[model samples]
Target: MSAIVLLVLGLAAMAAGYLVYSKFIAEKIYRLDPDFKTPAHEYEDGIDFVPTNRFILWGHHFTSVAGAAPIVGPAIAVIWGWLPAFLWVVLGTIFFAGVHDSGAIWASVRNKAKSVGSLTGDVVGKRARSIFMIVIFLVLLMVNAVFAVVIAGLMMKFSSAVVPVWGAILVALVIGQLIYRRILSLPVVSVLGVIALYALIWVGPSVPIQMPTEVMPGLSGNAAWILLLFGYAAIASLLPVWMLLQPRDYINGLQLFIGLIVLYGAVVLLNPTLVAPAFNTDVPPGTPSLLPLLFVTIACGAISGFHGLVSSGTTSKQLNRETDARFVGYFGAVGEGMLALAAILAATAGFASVADWQAMYTAFGSGGVTAFVQGGAYIIHNGLGMPEATAATLLTVMAALFAGTTMDTGLRLQRYIFQEWGEIYNLPWMKKGAPATLLAVGSCLLLAFGAGGADGSGGMIIWPLFGTTNQLLAGLTLLVITVMLVRLRRPMWYTLAPLCFLLVMTIGALLLQLRTFYEQGNIFLLLMDIVVLIAAILVAMECAAALKRSRAEVAAEPE
Candidate 1:
């Protein structure tokens, strides 16, 4: 009903849960002892493992979790009405996401910073480790592929004018780094960089970039754009982290934070009337029921399997103290919940009329590119003080930049996982880092090219497949965390609540996808859904096996 009421409640819940409940979990249950030597300390390295301040680690954790998923998921879920979406985000964060992330960090700390995969093996069973790794690689592939489409769609719609906004942001980052971290005592350059960023926001529309035309031939604008995105990801992964991914994330995170604040302030100031229905009484013909669909639709904002990747991959290794993991991991989930709230507000508040909203929805319903650009434009113009056309273009550019960050990070993570997979499997070509890197790059290129040509329409097929795959990964992540908690001998109530909730929601959603595919008879979608369903079943089985092993281990030990 009232947007403000929902906002207040959601924000308050996030704060209290993070501050009070999370702290209790960390100190009483997990008992995160700072003196306990982490795997980072045991295997100290300047590159991946080094003790760092909690504040900076929070920044890293926040940036990793806050990505295109939050924006896209809420933007779509709000179609059902903001109430369901809002409730899911708030409650999910408190009961599911916060617990999952915090528990992951605690488990890693207790187990010498070994990854969730390794912990799963030790606690659950050796077989779970293999299952976890395979699941992770598949998840990363889908994540990289989907985000590639999202960014490319934005580029195609806004390439004519918004390129320079992204360029300006990147340039500002470079200058900031040079002045603050490199040149020392150069406040003037950093100040100038900030000014330039704003100036680009003002004058961004004048900058020219190539726009897709009919003459391009074969591929639609969306398809061609996505291909280029995967290409960029492949190259970005091969380079050093500092050169692209981290710097870009820093800039994007700041921009995203500012944009969200502006949008929320405007919404409160205007107090726009909600035009969309409180609930869509009549479900769309092919849509699933709200029960499971809502859970699948709002993966990133509520709970994501990908967070575990970030938690164990780099964040765990950089933790300054075991206790700090609670703040960085749990609070970071709350931060993402806030972003999802922003998206819900934007979607529900800014529409001028129900008719206008419906028209836009119908036009864009089948096209991910259309929905994203139009939604971005609506938020900028109606929720922020900006000209409609200019705001739309700016929003498109921002989307592209945000997608760029996701792609770069996804690609790098994928490469690392592939190399690990190779080593574990004893692949001859992947014994050395250089050859493995090349193989990873080549795999990315091939995937990109194949995605581009997969459908006669270029890359449209990738969008839905990406969504399914991403959600499946989230399910896998939930399974791993559930098993880890059980192995660590956490309270049964604490471990089983989130575990059962996610399992039911995810499996229900997967079955729904399978039904949709069977009815539509779309071979590609049908195949993808079948595969995801099988993967979900395997993940469940793996968790069960882990639980049995943990029980046996506990029983065999002398009491």
Candidate 2:
């Protein structure tokens, strides 16, 4: 029940798992032979395929994995209880996430630094490669759509009379990049940019930015917001990475890191008691049991399918040494788990009444920007010397920065996947040497359509679907890693432990999703649930087939 105890236990579990268990997996199973040549060395291109310092690579990996999902998932999970949320994150990351990420990096490295799709095909079976690609494409589409809505909703909530703080920060970032990277030697430009960012925050309330008052008469604000956000995503996807996505992510990462520090520092300074119940006895009639829903709700922080794409798509190609993959991949998973822990701490600490948290949740429904700002403000007001309004505004700025970072990174990743998808599908219109600008634009449009809200509400209908798909992708990644471990002849106990845990958790979650869809009777959600269920079954069967084939091959070798 003690927050400190839980924190210590969680951290300890993560450390032991990564240091002891993961290292064992790396040495015995993955066996990154020192003599083996990595793809980065074999095909060293300056662009996308260059070797980089392990530390720098770690930075890139961490920045890519740590995003709005980490923040949002934990924030919501704590609604059930910090205990369930915290435990799932800790245990899940240690066993499920860390292993999956580490294994993925190793798999990619061992297979000539190919993407997971390519590796799956080469190692498991040719059919696996196609499955991997299709699964990833769908997952990317859902991920980008969900995030687009999240950012748009935040923007709509926060927009005011003065220049939009997020917009200003974005502009400043572009200008800073131009000055430092392109124009060269303008320290003042960067300094002025920072000052301008803060000033815009100060003046945010006075500035007026247009928000659609009514996208459709019957549509809820959230729905309308989703549509508009996805619409923007479509456009953003087609643009050059540098023009918006990369710069935004850099700013976002900086702000998120700083905000986390501030929040954690305040938690330590205040040492507030844990007031929420450790478990909720009265469950809603239709909600899932703790066994599965907990894992599903905390997907990103614990383990995410998205990480596989990141690992194989970019990080694997840039790894300088095979040994570095474990550090970058496993450590990155732990870091994300810790971020979820921070959110758990924030939601659980200092509040005497559940009503207080409920009030914030409701406010989030109505006044998205103000709700988070006020939540942060409330924490500061209770724990520090800052004025409530000032604290709220400061927190709001931080939240905006965080969202912007997520949007930028998410959009860029979406763009990459879109281009790859185009190539794979062999779209004639997307011929070689086509302008990067054209591709960016086209990708953005595709994303916008999916992210847009149904019924002209402008709120995204895709998010619920996205959540299911995202978790499904994670399950698929875990399945692949498990097969890889088996192929490498890892210790049965070591490979089976995490593999079995994830299989149960993910499959249970999928079933629960199916049940929910049937009860809700939402055709779209139901269809997604069915698709995920099928994917889950397919992943399970494929692993079984691979394992059987490997066993037969071993028997025939006469060794």
Candidate 3:
């Protein structure tokens, strides 16, 4: 099969999803009302609740959620064959992610921009909020820790990426100050910012910043980079929305757009043959089965619980109008699916032949990451006639930027969770945002530096669990949204069906991983997996009880 055929097919499917299915959802289900006032206006605080342009907010939302997961997951899962990964990315985006993301934003907007964590009380009853918050906090801990390590690893392995990543941050700070405080127009800032970004990309290889023990005096290599990155995250998390997070993500969104255009254009011009098989009945030794693992492995590109967090936690608070939720939320999911499509295409067709592809994906450790980077190099080299090494370095820098955006956002959300918990537990000091911020950053540090793999790869120790936790969270988010819909007297089979399927598949994957951990005598992972399972079961039980009560109330009402 030709790569162009697959690319066209995947893009067409996504267009249909957006035009037909998402439109049906918007008109029939959500029924977004333009007359409805959004929380951005009701609150109207310049700090976090300021009304934002829908296009800008979409950039912020898409870039933050896209991260490395969409790229990494599909790259890894293509080992099973491109067919399974393709189907999941296409159908899953429409049915699962679209429903969850848009519904989450809608629920949050109607509830005055409360996060999904806090809104659980209204939908599932007040008792469920505490448990839901705890689950959310733990899930975020994993996100922060893993992302920090991932960023550090990239810096250590690809020194050239360090300059562009940090350079982008510097650019964001200057742009944020000039535009937000000095009243510069977005068009001027955007053009200037993009120009500066390409300059950084060009300068990265020439003057790469290398991490050393001398920088921090005791920490070296990955450890040194990890500490510095977390420190940056701490500062970034404390700044107001306009200062860092929003501007940096906007820049990242541009970078992603450029990368996508280059890759897709290459596919059209080069028309590479699919080097990877469409179906792999000949399973490799020690590889995971295609059943539940593939679903969990490709969680983000398909659907992620984390998307609901961004939708409800931050984006919902800044929406200018209620009707824009479909554009921001549903379209954001489709955008991510496009990124995943790029990943699948790169992994399947970027190589010259089957043997070359197999060599890059022989095992499931770091091979997938290498393949994605190298495959991307191949595509760029062919498409634009750039040197492969330079293209690979450019892609690495882009990937690191994606991880940085996700990390700070996760940290900020974690701070919010901590503050919420402080109030629930009657701790007055934790109510102050500073203390919660410190605590959140501190926990991420401990996990990233202390409990990680022996070479300062703490994220690796917990990496295997990330997929299961992510999918489980997605399932939980969908379930809560279903309950919210029932309360609104809306039809919910669309939400309910996906929720049921994800729960069953995710639970099976968790158990399979649990057994793997036990067999390997990895007690720490075993315990973590057990705790996640318990949390899932408890949350599911609460949803069931709430639904039962809802049914009884409907039955008793005069019809």
Candidate 4:
């Protein structure tokens, strides 16, 4: 297939999902209320609970959830074939992610804007809440570890990206102050922000920041990069939303769109050919089976549990209207699906022929990003006449910035989980910000540096598990939403089917991973996988019981 055909089909499918499917969900299932006073308005704090415009909130929510997963996951999953990845991304985004995200927003908005973690207690059972929180904590740890390694690897590979990526952060700090404190209009600030980031992009290639081994004695490359990245995450997570998190996300969001536009425009002009096979069961030695593995591998591009965290944990708190959840939640999911599609196209069409494509798949580690980045650069060079070096630098900056956004958001979410765990367990000290932040950051540090594979590639070792755990969390979140719908006496089949499907698939994936990890004798990952499987099963049972009771109640109601 020509790249244009694939691109057009993917774009058309997403647009249709947003227009028809999402509308049905908004009106029939979620029944988003226009008049409902959102938590942002009710709380009205300028810190975390400030009321945000729909567009700005969408940007924040989209960038937080998009990250490297959508790009990296699809790039890797295409190892099986583009057909499986493509089908999963399109279908999963509509049926699974859109529903999960929208339900999270509705659940939180109705329950004082608590996160999925807290809602597990209120909507399901208290014990289920604890289990759910633990699942979240583990998932965020994996997110932090994987994304830290991702950014570090990108920086080392494309040294030119460091300046633009960091420069964007500094620009965001200024933009945040202008918009949040001075009450500048979003359009005005956004236009200026985009312009500033583009300038940084232009200047980045000339001023690369290389971290040599001698810079930190024993630490170099990924190690030094990991430490510095986490330090930034720790600080960023603790700051108020308006200061760095929100504005930085907003800028990254724009950069994401710009990158997409450039990529798609290149596709139109050059019309690259898709060299990857449409369907291939013959993966390399040690590759997992296609069934459950494919589902988990492409989680974020299609359906991710992490989206529930961003929806309920942060976005719900800032939503100006309940109705906007449809736009921010559902559309946010569709946007991610598009990003995944672009990754698929880049990876599949990156090579000049079938042999070259197969060669690329052999090194799927950091090569995942390289596949997309190099392919993207090829398109830009061929179509737009931009220098290959500049195109690569620009794309790398966007990818690193996306990862950076997700890392800090993950840390912030982890902090919230830690604080909740502390309060629920009667540890007053944990409820305080400092201890909780420290605990969250410290756990990430231990996992990223200590257990991380050589040079902290530990994140790579557990990525398969991370994907499965993420879907498991999504299943748990849907279970919580199903119970919430029951309490509201509303139709829940929309949520129930996806819940069952995800839980079963994730469990299967987990089992498959357990055998692999056991054989490899990776004790830490094996133990982590075991704990996640047990917790997920327990949560599923509670949700099943609650769902059964809800059905029973419905059957017994007066006719």
Candidate 5:
């Protein structure tokens, strides 16, 4: 089969979901009210809460939720074969992710813009809140830590990407000022930002950056970059959303879309034949069963609990209107679906032949970001006539920028989780922004250096738990939305059904990983997995009680 055929089919599916399914969700299910006041307007602080343009908010939500997972997950999952990964991304985005993401925003917006964990207290009972917050924190911890490592490794390997990735930050700062200060129209500013970012990509090859000799003892190059990244995230999280996060995500969103277009267009131009099987029946010695693993492996592009965090944690606070939830939330999932599709195509079809692709996938985890970058660069080199160095730099910067945006947002969300705990326990100091941010960054640092020693790759230790924990959190988040729907006497099959399916798959994956972790004598992951499993069961118990009560109340009232 030709790559163009898959490309056309995937893009068409995303478009149809956005146009048809999302409309039914926004109007008939979510019943979004355009005139409903949003927390962005209600809170209206110069800091975290500020009304934002829909395009800009969508960009923020899209890139922050996207991270490197959509790319990394699909790239890795395709080892099982492209067919399962492809089907999940297409269908999951339409049915599961779109509803869950947009519904999260609507639920939070209705409840005065509380984060999902905090709002769990309001709807699912206070006990559930504490349990839910723990899961959210773990997810963020894995996200911030592992992404820091991923970006640092990419920078070390693709030194040319280093300059453009950092340069894009400077460009975002300028774009932020231009848009907020009204110094330029959005279209003009957008055009300038994209051009400047691409120009930086052009300049990156000439100005490749290498880390200076160890800043301190025991700090390897990767560790130094990890520290620097966390430092940047700490500062970025403390800044106002309009100033850094929004503009950075917005421009990154545009740049990524262009990168997607280039990759998709390359597929069309080259019409590369699919190199991997649609469904591989060949035996890999230790490959896990495909049943639940594929779902967890492709968690982000399909459906993620972390996207619920982005939606409720930050996106809800910036939404200018309730109706924007559909775009900012649902279409945000679609954007990631697009990215996931590009990843599948790059990993499977960008290779020259079946044998070449086979060499790359010698093991379950062999073909990852490396495969993505190499294969994608091949297509761009062959199809678009771009210099090989430039093509590599472009994709590398794209991955780094998305990961950076996610890190920035994850740190901020982690800060909020701290503050939420503060409120729950009545700790005045923890509720403050500065202290909360310090705690967030400090904890992530402890996990990095403390666990991984000099390399700061400790996040990978817990990353195996990320997919299962994240999916369970998504299931929990959906439960919250479903309970709200039951309270309002609204149709809730859309949310409830996905909730059941995810919980079953995620908990099963958790149980499977537990056995593996135990057999390998990995005590840390074993303990962490057990903790997550317990938390999910406890929260589900609380939510079930709440759901029963909600249904009883609804039934007692007349329609």
Candidate 6:
């Protein structure tokens, strides 16, 4: 029940996975060729397809995929029990997430850095690609919209975070030039970047920037923040990858790792015993059953479909060498696993007693990033002897930075989705970078304002579907990878096993949510769930057909 015990076990398992299992998967199963030309080098575009150093690429991939989900998911899932969430995070990261993420990057790299959605057309079928793209779009839409709101909410709620959150971007721009232009050595620049970022965090509380109560008539402060977030995302998306995205994500990645170290350090020093039970005998009345929900609830920390998106979408395009996928993609999964483990430790052990833990989880869907930041602040203060307000600002800035990086990547990925659609349907405008980015940002805003009304909070209305839809996409990503393995006549059991397990669990969870939505008369979510279910079914059929065709082609070849 000691926090250190949990932390040590999770860290050990993930380290072993990265060191041993990922190596095996990369060499034996993936058969990665060191000399194979990666898309980054082959395409050699300055904007989207620049070959990147493995360390910086890993930072971008890590922060983009880390987002708030890993923290939020495990933080919330602990309501079921810390033990279940912990085991899933440890096991799923090793067996499911690592393999899937690296496999996705490998798949995309082999196919010229196409996204998982586009790779589906080549590996699976065109029809499968169409369906897969829809699912991917919906997931991106939710991610871009909801994360904008999430970041804005955090900025509003923690005004002390405002300076650090905004200041990090300026620091990133300078670091980006320093690294890309080689004006400064990377080690020195990185150390300086981290130092500058932390300096901002130190100054944030003293000079908090609160949004005006009304930016204008009919626009509250929160709504103005949302608009500004989307505006920033739109600009960030259109900018070249190295300028803002890579450096920002990389610096954020550096600070977050330090943040995690602080958290894990706190637990080791204070040795807070878990107050939440291993299994909650006294369940919250309205909580869903644990079986399938746990899998979806703890989505990113364990295995998120979204990670596959990032792996294939952005990370694959920037891979310096084919072999770097293991370091960038799989180890990135380990980084997130460590974060989720910290969240579990924070939520379960941060509280003083069982009553305190129970009070936080009075209902399902409670205890997300707020729980993580508050609890993490407590541990930091008690263990590290940091002031509570300082500790809270630190954690808040970390969470906000994480969310902001996701929006940056999400908007860009959504832009890629539009460009992919253009390629599929032979539309010229959607293929253009500016137009695609506009469509990407435009669609999310439309959903926000069109659906949610004045406050631009409509994204929250469909937020519940994000977990289920994300899981479904992960399964389909694996399905596409499995089909590719079969086509190449590579051994696929390792990938296939997780794919099957996720599909079964996710489909079940989706159906359960569907029924619940219908019964509750929540027509919007019910319909969204049904649309996702249909898309999943159709894509599965296409992939199955593609799989059979691939098998026959392989079988007919003379040895």
lDDT values, one for every candidate: 0.65, 0.62, 0.84, 0.86, 0.91, 0.90
- Candidate 3, run of 10 with poorest lDDT: 211-220
For all predicted structures, in order, the TM-scores are 0.87, 0.80, 0.96, 0.96, 0.98, 0.99
Candidate achieving higher lDDT, 4 or 5: 5
Cα-based RMSD of the predictions, in order?
Answer: 3.5, 4.8, 1.7, 1.8, 1.1, 1.0
Which digits, one per residue and each the tens of the lDDT, describe model 2 over residues 1-559? 5555666677788889888977876787777665677888888865556675565466456656665666677676665666888878888788778777877787788777766765676667866666666677666655555555555555566665225444654664465367435664334544554565656666776674656666667565555555555555455545443344444443444445556666666666666666656775643344456776676667778888878877876678778889888888888788778777766776666455666655554421132334335555666677676676666666655654554444544554545555555566786554332343345434444555534434332224545554556666665566566666655555545445655555577677777777777877877777867776777677777777887887667657754
Query: Which residues of candidate 1, in runs, are more than 4 Å off?
Result: 38-46, 50-53, 109-115, 160-169, 172-196, 212-228, 363-384, 431-434, 454-472, 482-484
lDDT of 1 at 210: 53
Model 3 TM-score, all chains together:
0.96
Q: Candidate 1: deviation at residue 405, Å?
A: 1.6
Structure candidate 3, residue pairs in collision: 452-458
Q: Kindly report which residue stretches of model 6 are placed more than 4 angstroms away from their true locations once superposed.
A: none
Candidate 3 per-residue lDDT over residues 416-511, each given as its tens digit: 888877777889999887899999988887777688643456767877988888877787778788886776677979898998888778788888
Please give the distance, in angstroms, between residue 459's alpha carbon in candidate 4 and its true position after superposition: 3.5
* Candidate 2, backbone clash total: 25
- Model 1: lDDT of residue 163: 58
Q: Which number leads on lDDT?
A: 5
2 against 3, candidate with superior TM-score: 3
- List candidate 5 stretches off by more than 4 Å: none
Q: Score residue 413 of candidate 4 by CA lDDT.
A: 90
lDDT of 2 at 254: 44
**Which sections of candidate 3 miss by over 4 Å?**
213-218, 453-455
Sort by lDDT, top down from the best: 5, 6, 4, 3, 1, 2
